[model samples]
Target: MPKSYLITGGAGFIGLTFTKMMLKETDAQITVLDNLTYASRPLEIEALKKNGRFRFIKGDIYEKEDIEKVFYQK
Candidate 1:
């Protein structure tokens, strides 16, 4: 079975780097949760969207509903 990943801050530099590395090295599904804050890179995240295994959610970590939705995602 393929693994699944929930990556917070996944649009930031280090997070994006790790995400790309994982995408290249593994077959895991990646769900990226990011608020698109000043430091977040939208273009990079958009680029990742080209892959079928990657998903992105625009949300803040402080939001209970957002976190809950991700945790409860299928």
Candidate 2:
């Protein structure tokens, strides 16, 4: 089974690179949990978005509801 990755700061340089590397390796699902803060650029994540395995969520870590929405209740 493919693994799920929750990558914080995923829109930044290192994070974005890691996201791309993961996608290139296989069809693993990745959730980019970035606030899109001053340092982060939405455009940086655009290419990853083109991959079906990549998902971007515009949210802050402090927000509980946003975090909850991403996970399925099992």
Strongest candidate by TM-score: 1
- State, as a TM-score between 0 and 1, how close model 2 is to the true structure: 0.85
Error of 1 at 38 (Å): 0.5
The list of candidate 2 runs beyond 4 A from truth reads 72-74
Q: Pick out the ten consecutive residues of candidate 2 with the lowest summed lDDT.
A: 65-74
Clashes per candidate (backbone, < 3 Å): 0, 0
Q: Using lDDT as the measure, which candidate wins?
A: 1
| Per-model TM-score on C-alpha atoms | 0.91, 0.85
Clash-forming residue pairs, model 2: none
